[model samples]
Target: MSTNERLRRRIPQQDRSRAMVERIIAAGHTVLLENGYEGASTNRIARTAGISPGSVYQYFPDKDAIVAEVVDRWTDALHARISCVFAEALDGPADQLSVRVVMGELLDALGENPRLLRVLIEELPRSPDSRLAAFERRMDDLLTVWLRFHLRGHDAPPVGAIAWMLVRTVENVAISYVLDRPPVERDIVADELTAMVTAYLRDISLP
Candidate 1:
């Protein structure tokens, strides 16, 4: 089933019901982070929310459903933050500074909740339709457009290919830094990533 279908439950139509659903999702987030995916249960989430297990069932069919909601909300917030950064970067020259700004924001966003990010990256089963996959594809599209416009007068590889490489490279590096907790400082990593990406784009766009 699609993610939307799997997450779809009895949609709460009233304000109170919507608020209750939000509370359950918040509780599910906490439980998932505290207990990991396997340890998380409907009863545990219900307890976390200070509600009966039956009440949780009213909004979500199962533990997976509740966790899906939690993951969706978290990824949505991350997407918004990154998208804003991308939008702003597009307005300026695609220089080292713009690249650094984007990388810095990415690190900050992914580092906001390391435990939850770890759970999502390591514990959750990913599908092509997953939120993370979708986020990458969106980023790819955005970067492709930016590259095409910026390299209009220069010879360059297919923007699609460059975008694909760049999106994955930057994302995996940021994820590793956040999850692995390397001894290197974040500013240094951001500087290195910016220099690498800027140089690659410049080389590829040369006549």
Candidate 2:
């Protein structure tokens, strides 16, 4: 009957709701990957997840909500991967190779999840607020913090500007690869792009 006990009692319900949300998101992802954007439907996703269609509705009012959560999950995972790669460089000196290393890691990670990325790109415009806008904001915030953290001793480009440029550049590269329109070999393309950007920054940041 105590207040604290009542609050503790709600924790399990919240946890269960979160778990259901995750399951629905996962189901939506699989459906999207298999069916592409137009083919994916709430009923199919629910069937794929072994849940009733109404149950999915309980967690998500519509398919767009599911798509948003799927995109958010993908973004979180991508950030975690990049964060682990950058954590070592964040505390110490910055170097061209470190930049290359981060870029390479991002390219590699995206390569591994190309299908999911494709689904994301396809679903972006469909989002109510549009995933592209949200993604742009998230990428800028994360990259600015990480870049400023690492570019300690270096007189680097303005963190916010560089963050936007980096996100835009990498996103274009990723999209090209996703669409099979990359100008050259995808593996070498990211490295070359990183090298170009690194050299430019080094030149501009020079005293």
Candidate 3:
């Protein structure tokens, strides 16, 4: 069966069942945080959720499925927060101030859950069809639109390429700041990133 089909098969349809599934996902997050991916088990997740192992199996086929659901929810939330930042940027000129706002918001959002962020970046296995990859693609499209509007009539690299670079650069640096616990202050990191991105955009916009 297709991946989507497998996912659909795992989702509970009834209200009570759905709540149980959510509980399991929450427990999965806790266990994954406490135990790391290799150490997390369905029994541990079930214990954390205050449910039996069979209950966990009722909602999810295996430990990996529960972890996927947890990651999916986390990515969806992070995607929404970052997407809103970009959406707001579309209304204003993509100036240095706008770039600063975007960078600041990104750092804040990613820093909100540093432990989970560390687990995601350092522990989880990534695949092409993973939720994280999907989140990146969505951000790329949003950024491409924003860049195209601001770079109109300017000699620049392909907007898609610029958007891809910007997304990856900002994501990596922000994740690093959150996970690495660098001695530099948060605002300083945001300021540097903002300056770097703003300068790059300006250079590209030049004829």
Best by TM-score: 1
**Residue pairs in collision within model 1:** none
Candidate 1's residue-wise lDDT over 1-207, tens digit each?
866777679989999999999999999999999999999999999999999999999999899999888898889999989999988897777799988999999999999999999999999999998888999989998998888888888865689998999999999999999999999999999999999999998888788
Per-candidate alpha-carbon RMSD to the true structure: 1.4, 6.8, 1.8
RMSD of 2: 6.8
The lDDT values for all models are: 0.92, 0.70, 0.86
User: How do these models rank on TM-score, best leading?
Assistant: 1, 3, 2
What would the C-alpha RMSD of candidate 3 be, to one decimal place?
Answer: 1.8
- Tens-digit per-residue lDDT, 1-207, candidate 3: 766655552668899999998899899999999999998999999999999999988877788888888888888998898889878876787688888888999999899988888888888888898888998999899889878887888765699988898899999999999999999999999999989988897788887
Backbone clash total for model 2 is 0
Minimum summed lDDT over a 10-residue window in model 2 is located at 3-12
> Over the full model, what C-alpha lDDT does candidate 1 score relative to the true structure?
0.92
Q: Indicate the worst ten consecutive residues by lDDT in candidate 3.
A: 2-11
Better of 2 and 3 by TM-score: 3
* Residue pairs in candidate 3 whose N, alpha carbon or C atoms collide under 3 angstroms: none
The reply for model 2, stretches above 4 Å from the true place, is 1-22, 90-94, 126-159, 181-187
